[model samples]
Target: MTLRTATAGDLTAIMDLERTSFPTDAWSEPMMQSELASPHGRYLVDVEAGRVIGYGGVRAVQGSADADIQTIALAEAARGRGRGRTLLRALLEVARERGAREMFLEVRADNPVATALYASEGFVEIGRRPRYYQPDDVDAVIMTLDLVAWAAHRAADGTALDAGACS
Candidate 1:
């Protein structure tokens, strides 16, 4: 798998996976287009055999103390291979490089795999939004991570956090 900065040209592929992963509340094309064009957002696509299979994004303004995880999705066939974790770590690194001290994200309450991934990354649940996901009416799990502490922990374990590893 090859992960790299996403371009507008990858929109169609990204949307395909996005809709498949989040059928109940997939982002609209216009909204996704605006996100890809936003200065505050950094998106990445995972490609395999020249086909886009996964994608994720983070919104971090320069000099900001906090950032938001915009989204992360992998094609059904690509699940359970640590690709999602790789995409997530890359996004966190991007936010940290942009001067973010904390990272925040919301996951569907019904999605245990995603919630577990975030939790394993040191994200702690801070709150929840009832029925935040429409159509499905699933609750949203709000989680946050302190980048400083996370980096320190990784260093202590002698594990280098290299976003480029995915690239």
Candidate 2:
């Protein structure tokens, strides 16, 4: 598998995954196109055999003190293999590179797997937005991570957080 920055050419594949991953709340193609064209966003696609298997993005204006994880999704076959974690770390790194001191995201309250993934990445539950997910009426669990502390912990453990690592 390979991960790289996303481009307009990958929009079709991305939309496919987005619709499949979030069947009820998928962003429209126009919205996704706008996101890809946004100056404050950095999006990435994970590919295998020239096919996109996962994608994610972060919104971080240059010199900003904080960033938001816009979205992250992987094909069902790509889950539970650390691919989501890899995509997440890459998005976080992009945010950090853009001078963000902290990162924030919202996950569905009913999705334990996603919630656990964020928690394992040093993100703490800061608050909640009741009934934030429409149609399903699921709450949104807001989480935040301190980039400086996260980097320090990684350094202390001697584990390099290389976003480009293929394995």
Candidate 3:
């Protein structure tokens, strides 16, 4: 029932969530460990009753602030009750705080739920790449969101948009 900044110690649980939530595209343990340890990325995790339930992270790059919505997954038993939205906003907030004005990500075009969530957050469909996701050969549709307003709104409203309405 709480959200906190992610730390290296959270990797084991984070990896578990990744494995279950994104079976085909989960980050390797080393990669999650590295990103959690990174000085360049901002990671936020949701924990409930001492277990990691959800997490999201982003890294700023170049001058454009290209960001990767590294991972977002709620523990299977923890799904529903709006945990995902809260985790997502927490990550976006951190990204903006770290000088990210714009963010980019690729999602499976067929994931209408995720697509709608991003769209609600002001992420617009920009372009697409054929077979961006390997093995399954599923295409990834690129989406971009302007964090300037997202930041301003949160600052101005201060959680006016709660965990249930991130998208």
Pick by TM-score: which candidate is best?
1
lDDT of model number 1:
0.92
- Clashing pairs for model 3 are 120-167
Output the worst ten-in-a-row residue range by lDDT, candidate 3.
Answer: 158-167
Write the residue-wise lDDT of candidate 3 on 70-148 in tens digits: 7677777876677777777767766665667888888898788788888877789999999988777889999888888
Superposed Cα RMSD, model 2: 1.8
Q: What C-alpha lDDT, on a 0 to 100 scale, does residue 61 get in candidate 2?
A: 99
Pick the lDDT winner: 1
Candidates in order, TM-scores: namely 0.96, 0.95, 0.85
Q: Please, what are the lDDT tens digits per residue for candidate 1 over residues 1-167?
A: 78898999999999999899988899999999999999998999999999999999999999999999999999989999999988898899888888999999999999999999999999999999999999988999999999989878878998756775654
**Which residue segments of model 2 deviate by more than 4 Å?**
162-167
Ranking by TM-score: 1, 2, 3
- Candidate 3 lDDT: 0.76
Model 2 TM: 0.95
lDDT of 2 by residue, 11-67 (tens): 999999999999999999999999999999989999989899999999999999999
